[model samples]
Target: MDTERLFDRSYERVLSHEVDGRAFFEGFYDAFLAASDEVAEKFHDTDMDRQQAMLMKSFYHLLSFYASNNADYYLDRVAISHNRHHINIRPALYDLWLDTLILTVRRFDPECCDETELAWRLVMTPGIVYMKFHYNRDSIVGS
Candidate 1:
């Protein structure tokens, strides 16, 4: 099956569950903070309301990228923004981020299933790859 179609179906299933976006992010942050003290410290001075909204938009952009491939623009920007010189989003953090997201999805998304989890993984792979590449590249340059 095509990736776009699969992602759309899974995304629709999640949305159809009628999960509140705000509440979902709150739960996600709770889980994420518990998973990593480093991640929590990074956000200590940040405004969560704005960050949550941006995270939702970024996820939607990631899902949409499978279809249009246009969302790759933001993906690149995200990679650049997370580089070592900026937010210093290391590869390990991406693993933690994905783990937290899946856990939160299982908690808040009533439609969560193996397929939904796979969709999230598949859809996020490209952006995560990009972020990891840039992080490594920046690390090399810094060294």
Candidate 2:
């Protein structure tokens, strides 16, 4: 199957009863916070519940960017928000984010394998690239 098809199916499994709603996302955050002190410190004052909610929503936008091959308004806004002038998320942190997410996927998605994990990485790359691209720009494309 194609990358999109593989990712779509596997991602569904991640959200299914086996993993349960919110559990996978919650677990990802837990692992992410412990993955690196930088990550934990970055979110030191964050409201975790709200942050997890945002992450769940952002996953869709990231997939949309991969499927559409364009950073649409929503993704653009996200990139802008994460830009150096705003949240100041460093470029290297995106690598950690992607790695952490994939590992978390492996844990939550029992069906996860090399292909599925690669698909997740491939799918999230565009959005991560877009965010990294805007790290210095600090402005959205059509804004």
Candidate 3:
């Protein structure tokens, strides 16, 4: 099975009205924030409306990056902004982020299974790794 196609199928189900629009993201952030105090503190000043919108766009970039293995303009922007010079997201936080996302997927997607969840992780991990790789390398790359 194609990971991207399968992942997209499951993700679309979670996003559709049947599951409630924005509900998945809301749950993801709620769980993600609650998973760690650092995560909560990082988002304490954030405008979630905007953050969710960004995340909505980001998922596509993640899928795209995974499918193409190329950090396109949008993905590059995401990496640069989150690099050490900017938001400075810790590498350790990504594990919590992915776990929270998969947990939310299980909660929101009625059809979710081990394969479905693995698809999500497989599709999202490259982008997560990209973000983490750029964290300290921002200096050499000129973020």
Candidate 4:
């Protein structure tokens, strides 16, 4: 699946009226909550602390900043903050996150699985790397 096709499909899915932002968020939130538990169990750690939950919420907000008026500034600020504050970004957690996202998208639009999977892989691969790099850099610098 090429990028253009994938994006087109994503756009189509977005405009289909079958998939709403609220539904996406609700699905994502539920998936994240479930993944958090799996993460804790897999790592022998506890559920995410309040601080972690707050941080995750902020990340979601940052992702949505593109829909706002000051999108560029908001995006830049989000990137900077991710670079400065998210030090302990875990790959396993991210895998779980992506899984959740995929599941959510599939739940909403089963027909778009192939396109969604391709789009998500395209978007998330670079995103995860960028996030992890900044997060690790932040940890080292902050410490």
Candidate 5:
């Protein structure tokens, strides 16, 4: 998948104004909301909207950690925090995120959709669990 290269391209696209990173993030956020809505419906919970918003904030914090490009501390922290939060860590949420990313990439550069998907798949390797909050206490928590 050449994740490094793909990340480079993604950054380039963002920096060069070829694609609006903010807009892409918004789409990703919307996907999270939709996934959370589905999960809430399945569980017959009415707090899905609030849970989804909290997850979005947590994801933003993770993104900031990644942007720092420091030690792998953020990875471990994210992993542990995700395990603790348990609302943002669903396979269905990941599927929704991937779909949103694919659509965003296709909208900006149709030719890069395949590569973007490949890179995304590599970044989200098997055995990696997404974060979700089971307790309301962890809803506002972020890494």
Candidate 6:
């Protein structure tokens, strides 16, 4: 699916709803903390309110990046910030992140469907891939 359609669905069905947005992030964080020890430990000291805000912004930025074509600047910074040497988000962890996000959407989104899930995946994949790619490169180059 194209990013424009995906963004439209994401905005109208998910992000634009205030209560669902809160529920979605709550579900995502709860599921993420329970998914693995590594994940749990990573966020043990983090400020979740701030983290959630950042996630929301980053998610929108991801969608906008695809929708606008020149808005990848934020995503590039996201990749750098999440690189292994910094936040240490590994490539493998992105799978868990995506899974939990989709599960959260299913649980919280009023209009959740296969297409909705696919749109989330399609919108999120590029950012995840970019993060993972830069994470790997930083690992190699920084070492």
Highest TM-score scorer: 2
Reference-based TM-score, model 6: 0.80
**lDDT for each of the candidates?**
0.73, 0.85, 0.85, 0.54, 0.50, 0.74
- How high is the lDDT of residue 6 in model 5? 86
Clashes of each: 0, 0, 0, 0, 11, 0
- Which runs in model 5 stand beyond 4 Å of their true positions? 1-3, 14-22, 35-71, 84-88, 126-143
For candidate 4, write residues 99-120 as lDDT tens digits.
8777766766656667667775
Worst 10 residues of 1 by lDDT: 134-143
Determine which window of 10 residues in candidate 3 has minimal summed lDDT. 15-24
The TM-score between candidate 3 and the true structure equals 0.90
Error of 5 at 115 (Å): 3.0
Worst 10 residues of 6 by lDDT: 134-143
Question: What is the lDDT for 19 in model 6?
Answer: 58
Model 3 scores a C-alpha lDDT of 0.85
lDDT of 5 by residue, 19-40 (tens): 4545444444444456566644
**Which has the higher lDDT value, candidate number 2 or candidate number 4?**
2
lDDT of 4 at 54: 58
Q: Which is the better candidate, 1 or 6, if ranked by lDDT?
A: 6
Q: What is candidate 6's lDDT per residue for 1-143, written digit by digit as tens?
A: 56457546665665445453465666578889999999999999999988888887887787676566543666776777788778888899999998988887776667777787887787778767666778856532232
Clashing pairs for model 1 are none
Q: What C-alpha lDDT, on a 0 to 100 scale, does residue 55 get in candidate 5?
A: 47
Kindly list the per-residue Cα lDDT of model 1 for residues 14-46, writing each as its tens digit.
444534554767778878988988998989988
Q: What TM-scores do the predictions have?
A: 0.78, 0.91, 0.90, 0.56, 0.48, 0.80
Q: Against the hidden true structure, what lDDT does model 4 obtain?
A: 0.54
